[model samples]
Target chain A: MRLAKVQKESYDEKEVLLHLKEIEENIDFKVIHKIYYPYFHFEFNVLTKGLMKKKITSGCVIDGVNGRGALIDCEPGFNQTPIEADQTIMEELTYGNAGEEAKQFMYRSASIKLKSMSVPVLALKKKTFFYRPFYVVDDGDKRSNHLLTIDSITGNFHPI
Target chain B: MKLDGVIFLVYLLVLLGIGLWFSRNASKSSEHYLLGNRSIGPAVTAMTMQSSSMSGYMFMGGPALAFQQGWYALWYALGDAGGAIINLSVLGKRMRRMSEALSALSPIEYLEKRYESPAVRVIGSVISIIFILAYVFAQFIASGKALTALTGWPYEAALLVGVGVIITYTVAGGYLAVVYTDFIQGIIMVLGVTGIAIMAFSHISLGEVNAQLASIDPTYLSIWGKDLAYYGQWGVVIGAILIYSVGYMGLPHIVVRHMSMKSTKTVKGAIMWAATWNQLFIFIPYLLGLAGIVLLPNLADPEMIIPELAYQFFPGIFAAILLSAIMAAIMSTSDSLLMQAGTILSRDIYQRFIDKRATERRMVWISRICVFAGGVIGCIVAIYQPPSVFTLVIFSFGVLGNSFLVPYVASVYSTKANNMGAIFAMIGGATTNILWTTLELENPTGLHPFLAGLIISFIGMWIGNYFGRTPSPQIQEAVQNAKTRKKLSNPLEKKISQDMASESKVISDFVRKKMYINEGDV
Candidate 1:
């Protein structure tokens, strides 16, 4: 499958590992496996009505697992990549229904920011499926067998 | 029906109309019916929460307490004045975010999900259903009394009419109906009470009233209450204040307000609205109660002070409208309580245990049925006039506050809180309140039942936590997320990234070791 991935702009593997070690000194980190989390990305041409009509480019990313859509302030670059069958997780939200949901989310954000009853119409400029990278690490604690995920993009930690 | 009765009937009809109008929308989905699709804005959220929390207790029970106890009753009012402010500020934002994250439709369901235990759901549901029903019964009785005073009907007939209207509207309209009507009722309540207070004050200034009260009985003017009944009983005084102040945090019906708010941003505006409305609305009833002692010195039932004061101060049509305010207070509270009880029954109990696969339509029907049954039962019990509205309200409110306050607060604030801790806290607090009230331990211990129960509940949480295991990492992360108000800065994010490097390095070493082993074998 042709899977699209967000360009890794932050850190390489060795650098990421070095940073992770300084944060969590207690746990004996075992193995790290990379997994792809699905998100539907959309770019929109938002028209604002004021003294002058202005067109602004905005983007949104909707979580494929929970169907939660969020407006992204800056557009992130993406590239097409071959999906590794073992590393890719399936998305629960279908691409067919995500467009309308994404549009509604973007519209709300634009209207709120513009504070206008005459909210600019949002035209979809581009839409695509993108996979975000996350590193899942096992804490080799025999007693608890804990697992934690680090967002390769943002470096946020979520213990599961 | 009299003019007042007719006005009240029209009001009831209007409420029923609103409920039926929303019924179509409410039936479309269980979420709509139970939580109004979380679309309620700040103003409506604040009003509904305040009106529901105040209950008929404001019009009847509160004034009655003041009439009997004198200025000491103002202690309750003092706490109540800040009750919504405290509740909204402390729990509003975090609870809203947490409930959404957990996808919990009911407060009881939220507790279970937070604790990750079915047992928590069962215990929480049972406690909420029982106490919320008890709270509803108090409203039913107050409604009957207020209606009887207004229309000159027999208590039985008034009980049937008043409770009947409340149940009808609640069952038909669901949460949206309950909340919007509460918003309207909230307005009527402030207007009615304020009008009466103005007229009463105009008739007798506070100084003159105090002079007369002192002349009648010196104890009537005392802060310690009439005859110093609660003199030097700071524990009792503190309990009186805490019951309405912090007490609101524990009530499932009240806390559900947080869950159904439009968003976390709703909290700031809601706190402002609630604070303003509460300052206008809460202290007046107690002051009127104090005024009642001087104005209506020969009153038969102390609870009838507000209604009698309205009739004495205003003419027929105006007084009747004021009477409508009294009924509004009762009905506003009754409907919310009924809606909450029904939600608990249908969502927390039936859907969770009896039939997990029940469709949205069936669940709505079940909720309606539960509400109707609760109203009918409440009416039947209210007809017997089981106890004074003040007594019933305080008892139930005290128990509920004591039971759930610790657990609810812990859920958002403490990551170590587990299923056993919640269960113990709930049981300990409720049992303490019941025992303290039933055994009448306040006199002997010099402590209010509510205060005693709260102490025990907190201790129980601490002890039970020692025995309970730490919550799952996912739940801990959720608690952390709930507490976070702003995104991590680049520097902080980088620091976190650095902290997690050890795990990454270990994983990298393991993978490299496996590759080297494979190469050697080849």
Candidate 2:
């Protein structure tokens, strides 16, 4: 996607590249085939791509805190949605980041494992399933929306 | 060890022994760690659900409220039963499925994954720690007070003995022991509370007391308080009830009950059973409260209601037995909190932070240690204690309700909220509650700080997203899943084969049943 400002574009491209290299080192894989920062609002493209890198983000949220993914909304920068705040949440969902366990859980393969892996969860508009339990209350588009945390994996956001 | 408290002491020992028996398996895996391998039966599940929710507040404080408030106490029962209804109808099946499907063994784990926010997870973990302590401490203090009141035992001694039993059993047996013991406690509560209420009424000419109360003030028997507002319009009563209904859906400890069930179908019969018992049991306190308003019209402290009744009507041994029921309520609540808090710390936060790769095996041991540690901390907090057990329970509920309302509701309904909304709601709610309660803010209509906090929290969440762009595609998919057509409300019976078929066959049959297909014979 076209981003703003030449310097901004170069900085973002470089940033994504660095993040991609780091992730490859950590989990030994390539994930973010593409990146979109039209708004450059949600700066954690790396994290968003981390989800896409694994197949977990492509899924839907269970009936958990307003399926917009637990913490990070699909909205990049502004809060047009009901979500109140944004924080980086990182969780280690699999034993091996890129191994069969990770692949199976990510792909929703192996029915038994999937059954053990899925839950009454919530996903974001981006189709990222927040695999945890929580609640949400929307008053309306204008006054309703809250992404209250429950529990998910560790890598979704770091403890700040 | 003295004559009067010996039975209770021995009873505690037997309870501890049972807990020890369960501990062997409890120390096996995360499934066994928090959920008892999802093998709990319906009856036990039902009772555990009830007793754990009722807490010590139901025993000592519930009766106290009933004694003073007359029919007003019914609102409490109404809210509670309504809350249970909400739990069964809205959350029971979904939660069970989520837990089993994700193998996301506990409440916080689900939160951690769902939000994909360690910030949210840690916040939740911390809340579980803070709020749960208030809850657990309330129970410990109540139990201590009850035991001491029943026998002239030292309060500290009573506290230790009572809490000791719970810690031992909970640590040893895991979820199963808690459920089975709660089953016992729930039965004891029904029989004891009902029998005692009846006996209390029977001892005095209840009609005479009613007549006396009417002579003094006709409004005493009125279900609504004597005021300008309608019964449902009042801030304290209706607000509390309203809060409770929503609160029940969000409480980590309460919802986790479904996670321990073997099947979602248990929710069906369990609901029917729970509702009947809840209605009847909740009514007992309301009635007793009404009785107290009549019999002891100018009582000084509300907490004295049960003790006065016990001392007034029954023999010492029977009074002791009556107090035992009260103790049971307190213990059940505290034990559940201890278990929940222990799970949060051990599995959700500690393991995640200290040992990234902590195994199911280590988690089991940590969970046991967590239970004991959590219980001890709560007991310490009880030293400064709420005036009564009920207040303490409500205090924690208010905290949880204020902090959890937005996220709880959002988890089920909205797809726009994200981690920001979740954390913001919690922080906003908690901050407002603390400010209001601490400052003793007297709003014109008497809205508790908790109510205000809840409102503010949702507003914060909504406002944050109001300025954001559309959710990413991944988030949209996650939201789509929330709309997964749910099945029967029964936690145990859902998704099972009617003819006792294999698990796969059960699914086909279950799917057909969900589809409203009647063409199949076993």
Candidate 3:
């Protein structure tokens, strides 16, 4: 089966290669393929009882393949073609109420002003869905295949 | 009836409430219980770090040393004032990123992953448990003393009350409760110390105080401590400073703060807040000690100097605040130590060894059990064989710092540091410190045991590296990733800074324009 084709490489390939080397030496890179990942960007307007307002922009990146949360360095790129992904997981990532994560972040900021403020008021200001580019590294023989994801933006790879 | 007694009771209730409030979050997952899901903000992070590090040592032991040795105490305080700053500067950002990258939940786990050896984890966990307990045991004793000073209660009764509160917060709510309570405690500590110092200065003139100290003993004002003729005075001074300054890196309870922060971006802000707190709070204790020389010279225990000064100088409510501050210091440290002990046992020992597939619920229960056991043991030790709080604190601090400093530093900053080197560093450092202290070798050696331990530990690490085994491919990769990760700065960091600046400006505008009214008054 043919994997998805990688269109744009905004991140430095040499830098990513260096980082991959750090995670493991002598990476016999059999096949390095770029897969576009998906995420939802969230901008929040946090209002507190101290009559103070804080505007925060944070992104929630979900691994398209695994359908789990990921920590990426930069926001997802605007232009990319989506490969085969779990539609249900993508819907949950984008359409799910920002209640859980927002509440956690709100509590953190709220406690700072908690002495003066009773409750934190968080309003979703903006949400955008975009795809991030990741280099999929396949190494070793067919029986002992290793997989690694290198962020195309910052060359940051989630430790396997 | 002393109104202060009522106020102190109120403080305890508030702490219990906070603990109960966080119990739900703590029970949700092992991560929440152990590290608050690493979602803590900069202010809370800074407060927890400072509050845990400062401890009863800063409140009672630090001033006591100053009372006995005069200006010489400031040598230790000087290092302490910069301890958090130095810790954050060296280990903050890198550790945060690396620990997250490695998915290490605790300090021992981090070392294990970094060095690629379960032996490192076992040895590290054992050392952490022993020293942390010793340290917490000292805090337990200090809690009793602080209570005795506040309420005129018997030592046993005070100990039970203090230990009960600490155990409740620690076991019931875990790390979230510890950090939240620590923030409140940190505020009280600073306010109480600053208030006491200001009142003491107002009550007595500096010139008169100095003159009194000079009359008592001219050496009290000497930079070399009470007796300038003492052997190895300078060595002792260097030891005192070095122990606190670099020792913080090795402290699992303190270093866990770096691991538990929301992100590496939060560190710069946390450092600013922590350094501000250190500057404001550190000198007050020594100053109070100096004032005690003139004010309460006939007191039996010098550690009670701060409490006596509070009662003598401040009003009833203010005295209660000061007493709570002392409790705050004791509780903040004991809880963190208790928490670390629990994490080491449940996560490092039980989960890793006993039950490899332990569920989150099971792990949380085990951690709470460990916390309770630690408290019981600490209480018994404090009750049965209480040592001088200052001496015990210094001893524990020295041992842990000396053992872990070389290994911890090597893991983060040095590429050549290996599992063998770390092993030797821990053994050499701890052994030297223990033998020197137990055998009373410091006097003859013309150096503090801590200094000797530190030196020997570094040498051990260096020599061991020569014969050290080559790193496994995975370990090499982890090291490389961590090192190169720092070189690639995340754009998210800059964006967060920009967001914070705009938020701060908005808050400032509201304050400056008097646009916000106190909802309380309304």
Candidate 4:
């Protein structure tokens, strides 16, 4: 399973907008989230994902839009959505083999089968724009934790 | 008739007032004197960081270099820009967090804690005294040269006036005064360099100068020198400029800026401001230098290009302002270096090793006395150092870079490093730098002594690391555990250890995958 920082507002109901810039850079994830955000998370087969056929380990990460990372996990259905962001706006992000051949390290990870999640925000008639940033923490036993902020109303993830 | 005298008085008064303003706190605590309470604001921090790092070379001597060379000097700005960008993205976060955690009283003190090597600290403290004095002397020479050129004052008289200004401000205000004055000086520098560039460019078109230059010498534009009169080529430009730019990491004066910043949030913003302003302002000298090529072809002394251009194009008031700006650049650099060396000698070396039990009040007084003494020593050296101001400044930077920064920068990030590495690095760098300059090995290659010294130091540090004593494993483990909560931890952390540690395994996997998707393969 993979995750993006979720906006605090709309923590429960909204589809989070995870930056999928890297995925777009290589194999496009444009068709994955064309439909409305999946409720209760469902499985979707990735076709022609460049290296999609290769099975990934529990903590392996792949680049998506806006320099966001999409990690492979053992969790249930995770709805991976895409957003539009370029290199200039967001900082550089990397996973397995970025330039360096020897060093292998990451910010945080776990062995669970985790899918990706993003909360989308659409404020047509509301005055307040809900935004939240999520942080992933590691348990002492090598497990993972995600603490995302919840939105006040309409409950959707927002990006700055 | 007393225009120079009056202006000198005004400068002295401003510096004095600022120095005294911060002296109150300095007298109360060495913390304020050495580290400025680690609460410096972004604006003051930006100005102080850039101005101190620049030294007087950017003002008078740089233009003088430009006058002799052409567009090639612009590489200095590019190198600085490159360095600033790296600082923001790479070193900035790490420095801000690491310095805060260590709470170092001096640059070397910070190094000791970071590498857990007291030997590095001792070696660094000694180097600080030696090269800083040399660098400070260079500033004094630049200041004296500017004063003499502008007012035709006696060299000794000029040196005295410059010293007086440095002592007054630094003795009174301490870091706050230095920061405030640097902001003022930074503005003056920008105004001065911009005005000079504009006035100089207005005198001739690039097409005209290029044409004139071509008629004079076929290879004038080439990086390599065809005649005796030539600017440095790409290697010199890249090598020299690269040294100027990335070299900030190794510089004691520049590193202190990060330690003095307001907060972590301010680090990025301050960096952006300092980098942009520093790059643009310092770069203007390139145009002035190129213009000097066309305007004054056979001029033996290249340093006079800016002043000559000011006199040639603008009216009297404009000339006065340009002169003020030039002085602003020179004085601004000298004052900061004077204060830095004074504090390092007094608080870091004298107070640390000499009198460990000295009261904060007494230390502040000692620092003040050192400022005065340092200024005096610099004046004496500048008045008599080997002829030219530019050479003096280059020598000073060479000594500091090869010896001080080489060891200092490397020790900051590495845990396996030791005191042996620090000593060898300085020795190796200085030895190679001297050999290069003396043997003229860098002659055809055009690599500067400072850069050569740094490269040598890099090798020296490795040699030292291999032979030096390593820390115990238990101490190393404790340092690592403590470092886990650092705000500036490497992005590739194995475990999340901060307050955010309660996140779920499910969430961590999701976020990591999402994060990796954007990051690409790293």
Candidate 5:
């Protein structure tokens, strides 16, 4: 399957390794593998009608694996080039389901920000499937083997 | 009905009404019924967690233990007071995120999804069903006792009525009813207990009560307990403290509260609510028991200390309200336990194994049947009155804590913990607790059964992990995501924005191009 991916603009393998070393020293770490995590990116043109009409542009991301929706302040650019996706990482949530979740998230956020009784009507401007890169790293220490993941874009690390 | 009985009946009616009111919404979907669509706010979440954790044990078993062991019983109280804080702070956010990410509706289902194994769910269902039923049975007995005291009904009659009402409301309203009722119960519990404390103090001050207790048996005043029964037993002391303090994490009923919270933001406000409520409520039961030693000298059953004291000090109406509070403690915990067991039986067992394609409506019916069946069995068993409330509660609670604590903590904190580890931990911990208690290991080895079980469970997890396969990439990723903090540091946020700048620019340009094309068409 072809998957659109976000280009890594900040952290590379060397920088991620350095970041891990800075967090925890004395461990011989190596990248075991990388996975493309799936997300649905959505943009909406929201219009609210009341005493005063309001229109705003909003965007949100729905996690394809979990169906969790989050309102994002800014949109991310896709690489435009599509890459081959491994069959194992296919998302369980379909585009329609993700879009519905994104719409709900956008509506809730708009209503809260506007602080109004009027319901907001959300028009879908764009919806696209995208993937983010995450590197899985493991320390070779036999005694206390440690596994972690580093975001290839943001350089954030968390224990696996 | 007498005035007291009338008041009690009114309270029961209100509970039933509330339960029936939510019945329509609860039946809409399995998620709605099982987890209230995860919309519970901070106050309700904290109170429900506490009220469910407190159980009838707080009103009856706790006071009874305090009456028997003297000041040393405060150790248990101390643990109870801190249990929610530790439970919420450690497991609250992570469990909420992980359970949702896994799309698990039941705690047992959460374990199975986290470990990626069907057998995990099977074993978890079995253990939880057995002990959770056992736990609820203790509540049934407490309910009978409380009702018998309030209305002068026969124990058998009281048991049936109490258990019947609990099952009715629980089956009707589902989790939302249970939680909202628990919030009200939590308030009633604190007020009733505080009222009794004030009246007890007015009759005889704390100093005088202590002095009288010492005069009767100096050991009653000692931290070592009456006759120094547990003196120098650091193992026992620590176990008493650990049982409630961290044990809340292991309970399926309590941990479900974390999953049902509105969001991760609920944790902070919940912790504060739980801590404040616990301090106000937990210590008083044990203290009331201590005062019972001086006041109700000829009391027949130690478990009756609280009820007996309330009637002795307060007026008839106030005492009846206090009885309602006692009943609240029992019903709140009982309903939660029943709801969880039903969820496990229906979601983890019936649907997962028995009927894979069961419809949502069918599953809800199955859940209700399971809960009703459990209540019937519990009521029948409670009629026999096998053991003291304190003993039964401690036994069931200890086994449960031993069984699930290790696996639960490992699920969020350790990525490599696999199915084998969890299976071993559950079997090892539960077995050790049963054996230690049955064999009277505490007397000979000075190790509390709970402590013994915990040690074996941890060791079992380590051993089993060494032999088990590591989790798959998907599971590991979920763990990582669950551990990620919702709020990023200022510098980290700025860095993330900078990292995505190129992507942002590309999206902006694409949008602009699309707008220009639309304008040209116009």
Candidate 6:
């Protein structure tokens, strides 16, 4: 699975920088990494007695540039290639582990199965990776400065 | 009390679980939170739309009206049965296409983009917020009354608990949780009401019911209520019918459902499902109320008839489910209204003006806070118990329809509709509705307040358009593009083989043009 091309972009570098400045003060931040954020999605078929088989979908979004992550519950488009790690300014891209997140989902489903008399079998069905364009910002001098990501399409700022 | 507390607690926990589950990702982006990323399926979409539209009135107010007026209540049901289909057929596919092309996140945002005016955005947003709150306020009051009746809890306690649960799920999970809960609630509503109606029918036949009604009064079976000779009954009948039949077009909460559908091709299946559901269930509440005339002849409060009958006819657990069905009716509508109110404040009000460059996370938090605040206000209003839930619901619905119907309909269908027309129509319609209701004017031509407001709204649009400036070329082009998009004639076909590659390419080109998938990208 790979990142998808941004469907739309209405903001430029200056607009992103201006939005970043509004939230933080007296600090100069530069785009440390211009990369797409990766959102990992997985669909599974869980079979149980009496209740039949039900499909459970789960996913998580990783900032790709800053390593910040959150569980995702949306269908993301996937029609483009992922960014190569070598092409970016950062030494290595920080991507959330999709397999770990999938296990968490399985455990949650298993906890519910414990209440019922039926044994549940969980099987992986499909996996997709979606990416939205983001500009990872950091203050130029410090090794551990605060990281902020700006959504390129809607020009919304997110602290990562 | 006849209701089981454990069953109700389980329902609340499941709803809270759903909210917590979806809350993890809801903060990722405003689009994901507000519209579920436009990936909802036809079944969920249809169920959500129907559930959101049918509110506390379906349980309490509707049955009360039937108890008071007999079959005259059926006129309202007649309008409601086909209202969703008419609403979707006229606006669903086209609005979905147009909203996507315009990149409008909310209904007000859509109107702003389509009409090309900031003034339209401000006015539309204000009107929507006010009327939608009124709608939510009605639901809150009904919830308090229903909870108090079913569980013997204090009105204030019931109000707080009910509104608290609704606000929790809505604020945490946003639109995704709202739709999922609505789907479950929709099933509960249909099953509960149908089960009760079937039980009532078994106890007493329709013929016997009619015979009992006739003995009470011949007018009970008439299309007109008490006295048929009080002016022309047809005007009042038409007014009631029109309010429900076409009135759905103006509702912001309902209209947003059209914009959030998975694809334009999903419209047909969604409409069919919605219409079938409406046909199966719309008249059940009214029928149950009419049946009360025979079954619970000595019932004290007409509004409490459904719950009272549920307990008397069914076992405790089954009765509790029916009681939950009433709760579902109130909660479904309240959550959606609360969602729209919060979206209006955060997206349209705060994001648009107060903080133009806020982060998506900040915006999501602000929206949750707005939903909480709105719920509090609804609680305050519900505590006061404004105008018997049914009347308030109808009043809110009528005023909303009057205010936005002409402008919304014109935006989608009329090439000649201008910004001026929309502005005047909204103001005029709202004004007429308010004035008619406040002044308590005599039925000048036997026109109901709703019908009068609708008539004035159209007149306002026509008058404004005649005097208003011409629309810009860009606006005209956008409308034209929306209208000319190809229909999804063959959405189910999978692959075209090597021999049919050319045909496949042609079909693909048509779909791509109409679909707008990953637009402006390779």
Over all chains combined, what TM-score does candidate 3 have?
0.69
Error of 6 at B247 (Å): 3.0
Residue by residue across A1-160, what tens digits does model 4's lDDT show? 2233322222222232222221122322121111111111111221111111111212212221121222222222223333333211122323223311101111111100100011111111211111122322221222222133212222211110
**Candidate 3 residue B415 C-alpha distance from true site, Å:** 4.0
Docking tier of model 2: it is: incorrect
Off by over 4 Å in 1: A1-64, A67-90, A93-160, B14-49, B87-106, B174-182, B253-274, B412-415, B473-522
TM-score of each: 0.68, 0.63, 0.69, 0.62, 0.68, 0.67
lDDT of 2 by residue, B14-93 (tens): 65465445544443431232234245656555655555566567666777766655556667778876776776667654
Give per-candidate clash totals. 12, 124, 2, 76, 1, 0
Using alpha carbons, what is the TM-score of model 4?
0.62
Q: iRMSD per model?
A: 15.3, 20.9, 17.7, 24.9, 15.9, 20.1
Each prediction's Cα lDDT score? Answer: 0.71, 0.51, 0.65, 0.49, 0.71, 0.63
Query: Whose DockQ is greatest here?
Result: 1
Give a tens-digit lDDT track for model 6, residues B1-522: 434666776666776566445534544542354344245566555654554466688888888888888888888888887665677666765675566556454577778787777778888778777877887887888888777776788889988988886776455333223445556666776677778889899999888999999998878888877455324646577778777876655556322211111111224556567658766577888999999988888988788878877887888787876677568657766766666665676668887878987654565566567667778888877776457777777777788788888887888677788888888998999888888877865266576778889889999999988866677776776677667653311321111012112212222333344336446554
Alpha carbon lDDT at B2, candidate 6: 36
lDDT of 4 at B404: 61
Recovery fraction of native interface contacts for candidate 5: 0.00
Please give the fraction of native interface contacts (Cα pairs under 8 Å between A and B) kept by each candidate: 0.04, 0.00, 0.00, 0.00, 0.00, 0.00
lDDT of 3 at A104: 40
Alpha carbon deviation, residue B396, candidate 5 (Å): 1.6
* Tens-digit per-residue lDDT, B16-55, candidate 5: 5664455344444322432342455565556555545666
Give RMSD to native, each candidate.
11.6, 17.6, 13.9, 17.6, 11.8, 15.1
Candidate 1 vs 4: which has more lDDT:
1
What DockQ values do the models have? 0.05, 0.02, 0.04, 0.02, 0.03, 0.02
lDDT of 1: 0.71
lDDT of 6 at A25: 48
